[model samples]
Target: MNFILFFIVACALTFSLFREILKRGSDSILLTVWKFFSYYTTLSNFLVLIWFAALAFLPSSEIGQFAQNANVAAAITFYILTVGIANYLIFGWPKLSVYERISDLSVHAVTPVITFVYWLVFSEKEALQYSLIGYWLIFPISYALYTVVHGKWSRFYPYEFTNVQVLGLKKVALNAIALSISLVIGAASFILLGKTVGRL
Candidate 1:
């Protein structure tokens, strides 16, 4: 099933990333970027991309989300895997550069933000709420600064956002805002969960 495939890949990626983090100390800019990225995004997304590409055959209802609940459950599992990786990324590795540390920590920023927004949009049918964009907001804003920080052209770009526009700053700004707001919601949700669990 698609769920098992995704979960397994996610587990492997998490383990590999953890081993690399322990070996490398998560200090290098490259490691920081990798850790930041690895924490929040599943390697399975890549697998999903390949699965879709090989779509000479379409999946039956069993392979992927058979219902909205299944989709939510899958997303939650992915988020748990991500956070489990983050526990090590933040506290396990050697103390990192300020940039490395914060960026590495931002792995916690993506899911709840995106999920809450998905709920609002899918259920409430709203058009592009800001809470949907959280850690996602970082890919563009950070990449732009990353380009300037490294003083080179980044392969990353504004187009990754679901809403890209024609050759202007407005598109960038809009995307940034949406992602930022979503990330905030995500952070809040995580903190709330931590508190709830800790208290119980």
Candidate 2:
């Protein structure tokens, strides 16, 4: 299942990225690809692909061992879930071709749900701890910082909330802090759920 999911997500991400690049009609395909990857949605789905691949093919390796950790799995689940929720709440659904829609839904909707279900059924919660949530914040915080710096250079913000040009640095910073708080809360909830499930 992990290996199969890896391919499914990889195809979805690749198709979406290719379509985006085509739509842009940029002379530099590499730059377009870099911009496409700047989106949180793309990054989160890419993380899922990497996680699934690690679990499927390299379970004995160091990275695979890290990927298999319950807290790590839960963090991935949360990040992907945020992708879907943020899309729905902030962007809603945009009109797209059928193929494009399939790619979008695969990465934003199906991937997150299935990832959570997989974690619920297979993850070991015995080692879950509140301290690990701080570690999980590293990826998101780093991404937020990267988005700000990248947007300043390119004048392109992937999401409205992170658009410093219009929203200003103060607003963007506030938005980031708000999101960080929300993630901390969500991470706690996941830990609670995992600990509860582990007991049963």
Candidate 3:
């Protein structure tokens, strides 16, 4: 049942991504692909897509070991953002209707949880290395820079903390700094925990 459900969600996400890519026209595919992957949520979902693909095609293989450390980082970052969103909503609910809430919950909560569980069950402990810890900053930093540059022209920010138009550049930078530090810390902690569990 779980496999069936995950496969369906993965197909949906991949189809959605393909639709987005097709909308880019022949000339802009490269730029459109880059922009789509720039979003943390999309990147996280891409990881989920890969995981689902591996499980479907290579059932005997340890899918989590494919990109063990990077998978760890992505799972950590996804859950961190999930918790951050919950905290943000606590201060004031966003005026989301039932459908929006369900959509958000699936993307923000369900997917991340599945990622973490996949790591716990399928990832090989021997594959994790301390040297890869610094690599965790790649996506977060890239996304931060992209958010700033994209917001400048679009005047739209996905999250409140990174909203330059409203929070101002200085404050947005500060928030990004804080978030980057926290993300690294969270990633490190997860790595340590995964390593310890792998030992057992």
Q: Best candidate per lDDT, number?
A: 2
> Any idea what lDDT model 3 has?
0.63
Error of 1 at 142 (Å): 3.2
Q: List TM-scores for all candidates, in order.
A: 0.30, 0.93, 0.68
Over 4 Å off, model 3: 1-8, 11-39, 58-65, 68-96
Q: What lDDT, from 0 to 1, does candidate 2 have?
A: 0.87
What is the C-alpha lDDT profile of model 2 across 103-151, one tens digit per residue?
A: 7787789888888788888988878999888998999999999989888
Q: How many backbone overlaps does candidate 1 show?
A: 6
lDDT of 1: 0.41
Q: Which stretches of candidate 2 lie over 4 Å from their true place?
A: none
Sort by TM-score, best first: 2, 3, 1
Judging by lDDT, tell me the better candidate of 1 and 3: 3
lDDT of 1 by residue, 4-68 (tens): 44344444445445545655663875754454353234332343323322222334444333223
- lDDT by residue for model 3 over 63-182, one digit each (tens)? 544534455544553444544354445545567766555554555566666666666665665556557757667767877788888888866565678788888889988888888788
- Itemize residue pairs with steric clashes in candidate 1: 131-182, 133-178, 133-179, 134-179, 134-182, 134-183
Clash totals, every prediction: 6, 0, 0
